[model samples]
Target chain A: MNDAFSQLHPAASFAFFVAVITLTMLYMHPVLLIISLAAAAGYVCILKGARHFGKTLIYLVPFLIFMSVLNALFNHAGVTPLFYLSNGNAVTKEALTFGFYASVMLSAVILWFECFNVVMTSDKLLCLFGRLSPSVSLLLSMALRFVPKFGRKIRSIDAARAQIGQGSAQGGFIRRVKNSMKVLSVTLTWALESSLTAANSMKSRGYGAARRTSFSLYRFTVRDAVTMVLCAFAVGVTAACVVSGGIYARYYPSVIISGFGGIPALGMAAFALLCFLPQLFDAKEALVWRRLRSAI
Target chain B: MPQTVKKSRVTVTLTVIVLSAAAIAVETWLWSSRKYYLTSVIIILLAMLPFFARFEGRRPQVREIVLLAVMTAFAVAGRVAFYWAPQFKPVCAIVILTAAAFNAEAGFITGAAAGLISNMFFGQGPWTPWQMFGFGLVGFFAGVLFGGREVKTVPMLVYGFFSVLIIYGVLLDTGSLFMYSQEVSLKALLAMYASGFTFNLIHASGTVVFLLLLQKPVLSKLRRIKIKYGMLQ
Candidate 1:
């Protein structure tokens, strides 16, 4: 089943991700970082299967650790020195902690972008920006349409070459590269030659002679409205709390987090809700399906 | 027609200069605020806007649009064909050839389009804008330097090599810096560049190789098409 969250209007999903990613980048608080990271992972697992998510994690975890260690080694800015390398750069606790959290922030952002890719498809992006810049949108659509066609053409050219004993596969690396270039050259000529016909066809069709109208499959329903409003409210609360010093952190000379109080707690809760909103929707949909099956 | 062409050229140039200046201003502010990713992405997008605007305002001939689309598709296809060779793609070389055969505007549009479309197959990420900007800048510069000129294989190959190594490589490394290492210390940046050096070298070599092999044919064909269509003049 299509995830319940992705069924919302593109605007809604786009807004939620923008808010979540922005917050993830800005917030340095460990608790908030963990919450954002977990939420991002969970959302991706729901969107793509857990196996794919796991493969991504296997690649990302080492990268995360490497960045953290590199940061600690290079940045000697903090007060509490844990050790000193031969290069005389003291490994400070604050710097190490800062690096770890910063890496976490980076990981969370990457995962969120993964989710963004899944949810904000090319069609959705085209729909969102089509009217804003019709020429750019048209170029994107045309170029995208041609990419697959060109790929197929390249394959055909390669096959024809192979039949003529000029396959890229039978040679040394340099020879293979040269043979491939031969195929590409043929494709290029054909593409350029065919483009004239395409242009003539477009001209005859009266393209760009009038203002363009775009059609999108998505509609902003009441559910989408609620989602947008809730996301905005959560972001607003988080921003306000951060500005008011209710949610504050420093990891330069030392790690200091502001006391968890009424406003700060509320802000954290709101942020958490915003992060897990997609998962909640997915879970609700699963539960509904379960109940329907049981009733049947 | 010549007068109008000159007029549009002036407007496009003016648009690019003004938007770039504004982008620099906003980039300074965002950099100060440590909003690295947003700053870079916004700056790149702002820089690219004028090209798209020029295409729109000029209401280019159908052939012009088709030429741009075809070249972009070629670049994307080149990239896909060499997917097994990491960082070894002919995108830059193709962009350079397109620019040299046509004008800078065509080159920039082709490069930017290729970047965006290729990423559609590869999956878009935070790196998309950077890749788009980097590839576009390489094409833009190539057009400015070599457009409508005889593309000597050696000089063109040299340009492709250094450009892929420096322009595209540096921009992407800066992207990695912002995304992976939020801290923008000189040391961190150096480290990042160090890690990225081999990849950049491979990418640059790939461009040089492609340029060496494809430059003569690509240029001749493109020029032939230009003569045949009598468009993009």
Candidate 2:
């Protein structure tokens, strides 16, 4: 939790997301995603220690299996089924393959997001946007902040409701439906009150009455410039690939075009993006130290 | 002095001309490869300029920006997650609600921007313009009917439901005709809608229900925003 809390620096998270996405998009091989999945697991263990990692696997494993099964059942492609059904509508190998691929993709994305969720705290995002669009930025940050806070409030509300025998989940369908109206009304009231408070706070600060300026914690350095240049190249290359029909072949070899393909370009972009990772990490460390130093 | 004035005038004229050219080029490409409704983007882009020029406030309203960003995020996320997740039907409903609670123009701009933003995730090809038009149309009119909060339900429900179906139909017809199938006919278009009739019905009905449910809360809240932030003149 300390590690996760420390990681909640939006700039660092942004850099991490940019790097991971660029890399994963460019090198979308099953092998790479698997490696990423492993790497993510390793990082989690390192940060939260072995106990949390173990906790994650127990829940994640069942989810992965469920996702795999659901995708296979629904996809309905390819004729090579592993087992023959009584109706001869057996689950195809392709569907199963797609399912696994989909699962892997989903897991990889989720893993990165877990890291992101840990690092990019709401305060950081709010601070980042406080310049140009104060009201909106405040709303955004507040919304993000409110979600977790509201969630806690709702849990408390639920506990109170449970004591009163007013909790919907414990009741029958019709009763639940009747209870849901109360929940919805309560939640809506909460949202409205929150928005109003946030708006009032803005008004008190003279928000949106005059020109507002935003300040960003992130200072774009030389590394950032180099990284951006590389990303631009990657974007160009991807657009070229799309235009050339290399990425969208309906049938094998029919709509084939030129270039090292989608995955490779994504790699170069990732490489470009990742080249700035050291600076990102350093910046994140410095910010934390600054905060600590100030506190001290 | 006359030359600088001439230059500024020239710059304005040039900006207009360049934008017009871009619109023409985009429309031509879209028409050749996409659909008629797609060309309406050119029209919307033209519409957007006047607002920017007119609303030359030093800073934009925070509430408006926040609303736009949320809608935009939903719009982008919706399309990005389309094949894998539920359509951001809720986002459009929010758009509908926002427009109804505020101004028609607000809805149009928000809807259009949200649609455009959403297409970025899908890697915009041909269908973007029509989707924008669909969302924009819903939003622009939502304000006309519900934007003011006169407190009518049945008319809004009927209006919202048909609006959704029309938007979906427009999208399907444009997309199918221009890109997917060459022999795209109205019958084929209708058939597609018919096949997904239940889904469309549910989607439209659900939106109407959702908006109706949120109408009171959303309107009251937006009124607070306006009063607090001077969002409306």
Candidate 3:
């Protein structure tokens, strides 16, 4: 109903991402991986809708299976051997489990990044780094904007070339490739000349003559502050647990996972809470909106 | 102005040297300790920080920043254009051309930016840092070898071949090794390299093809723009 998490302070949103992604990569416990994957998928579905989730799955499922099988084929480092490949490497349970873990971790990271790309827009990145390093931030934001602009320009160039009977998709594979290179050369020239004008315009506006001040729309609200503190506390708890071997796991030589209890269980709970914080906020906002509408 | 420019150059050179040494030391420690995930993250951040600091201190002109952004965009667009072919992208060629035309720092920024922004389409994972490092090094070497000079076709082609190998064969393979094993072994390393040889070959050939076709025109056009705008001087 309400997607208010996206409106949080950029620092809050960015810190959430940095914390979750780092933990997802570092904490290899299967339970943690599963929890992260579920939360990441849930967040992505909420942000981009169900159709995008379906598309992600279409690409991700086969990739996960492929990685698992590849590892099973090549890595033979476990106590329990399932089978022997033709290349003489024994497929072990540990290898298979490790592959599953790796794929889950990889996909979870990727999904979180998808959410990041949607929520942490280029302007946020600029705002985050603009004060500390204006030039680098400018380059980052410009690069982000230019990517889509260049994509459109390439399409227009291709279309125009097609009208002249010299398009990239004209003939055999080689011919098409050569034609594409031609299109690329034309685009390169155009991009260079246009960038010069853009630069000159910035210079005329007194760019680099003094310290640049940027206008920001983001404000750290009370809600954002609460979210930031909650996130930091959760992340700190999880990191301490991980560092103290509370959620320790081993795959090679044997799949021995530490039993969940005490600090380890607490760590897992904190991590799950941290991962689901945005979703929980969104759901709460939706419920409040629905109640308000009913009262109205 | 000239004296300050010279002084900034010296500072940049010193920073790069010190950073490289620190990177090697950290890498040795990482390999010895096998803290692959955490340590590699630190190392990657370390690898990228000095370039940003160098740029901040030198304060590149607006035109140079714009040019770097455009070049990075072009490199990304090139990758998108050839998406039909796996591992066959013109990014390496464009990076080399940028390096040869501009200085190493600009080249590194372009290459790193291209690797990063392109991942927005290709998907990000642990492979990202290695990819960034590979492209950045390719650009760095090209700049060191032929910055502001006329790049001969034969030598440029050779460099293109080797750069792609380093990217796919060495850097990406190392990333794969880390992903697969907690501890590194020579056998695993060799096996990974052997398995990726064909993909690396295809990537290298693509670089050679693009470099042969795009080098002269791209380099000449960039040089003209640089001179016309009084950029990166």
Candidate 4:
């Protein structure tokens, strides 16, 4: 997980994900969808390795197909009917194409999100939010910390219950439910009580004092600046193209894809570059590592 | 400090209204652009902002912040614990109880935060905002309805059932339509709802069951903490 892109400032990586995911959701053009899906797949494969990528695709592809078929079944619009369902609704080619396009967009968005989760860890999120509101960020950080703690407590409580011959795993459904409830109740009381103590400790330490500064490990470097600039440029180019109808598409009476060569191609290329920037960074890092090894 | 809080509240309200109006305008203008999910995500984010803004303006105490964090974490843990049981998460029930014990604002924050943080483990996607919105609304309405009251088990279970079924279930199901549809129509929306009905029933039933089991002891504990600490009055 030593990807160069993720090593950038949290804001830089977060902005990139926002741009790519927004574009993926907004664009219905077939070429753009394919480009996004390919870039997302490349990023995921590089980020999580090939085997993980294959596993995700195995689950995702079927979902994509199912969604597309479901869309076609539900929606009976447009000209150029491909076939008719038993309910006498015409299955239009336009609807089917649109369905597939939507599915690709969804899959691309999902894959990009996978990359996002890997890159944007909890501390990164806290850092980003800390800049906005320290209170909210503190809450988020505490919640993040407490999730694991609470989980461990729940397990311990369950174990204690089992030790006392009151295991939730034993007995009928009602009894099991009651036993688990007892476990949850004890855990809840402990959480609330301990959290109050934690609050007191913070108060003793002057938590709400004026200008209470929080520490963050992330710092914006030269590399982050360059990555942000490139992402902004790509986003600007594609947004202009989309706004000006250069990458226009329609799927109603018929499937129409206009602005083929000039602006549309440029937009798609920009989008591809934007979407694949992480992979590019990873590749460059790998190349540098290899060169260093050779010199050594 | 009170004046500053009032001023900030006004500013937050204005900002939220203006942002919501702009979002709606863009959604309408881009009606044929097939960016339903994008606009919806923007709207959802905008909707959550005011709650955070208010919380920030209040200069809340450490106890309040810690309580919110603990509640959010517990809800997330509940979801994780029930991961193997599809649609059987105690998250909704926990959220409802949180709202009932605290204020609507607290409930909203806990539910929304839990939705987000839990997804950090479950994997996030286009559906994250919708889930956040759904859970937030469930918590909010529960707080509005039963906050600071001794909620009986039967009523709590009933509310839990319907809130999950309607608020969370409908919001998520509708989100799927926006995500997966090129052109939304009544027929298509109905189909989507119908397809999701079984899953929604399971989720709602799970919520009811959790609420039924958890109502008395959880509420009593929350009441004890609230009185003992004088929290979030």
The model with the greatest lDDT is 4
Report clash pairs, candidate 1. Answer: none
What TM-score against the true fold does each predicted structure earn? 0.91, 0.51, 0.86, 0.94
Candidate 2, which segments miss by more than 4 Å at Cα? A1-139, A170-174, A208-215, A231-296, B1-94, B105-137, B168-197, B216-233
Which of 1 and 2 is the better model by lDDT?
A: 1
lDDT of 4 by residue, A37-128 (tens): 99999888878998999999789999999988877887787888888989899988987888888888888988998899999987888888
Q: What share of the true interface contacts does each candidate keep?
A: 0.72, 0.06, 0.72, 0.93
Which 10 residues in a row give candidate 4 chain A its minimum summed lDDT?
Answer: A206-215
lDDT string for model 2 (B33-92, tens) is: 322332344554565554333223224455555554444443333344334534425556
What are the runs in model 1 whose C-alpha is more than 4 Å off? A170-178, A284-296, B1-33
Docking class of 1: medium
lDDT of 3 by residue, B63-173 (tens): 888899999888887898789999898899999999999878888888888888787777666677778878888898888888888779999899899878975468888
Chain B alone vs. reference chain B, TM-score for every model: 0.88, 0.66, 0.86, 0.93
Model 3 CAPRI quality: medium
For the predicted complex of model 1, DockQ is: 0.65
lDDT of 4 by residue, B122-221 (tens): 9877788899889999999999999987677777788898999999998999898887776778877888899999999999999988887777777888
Q: Which scores greater on DockQ, model 3 or model 4?
A: 4
Error of 3 at A271 (Å): 1.4
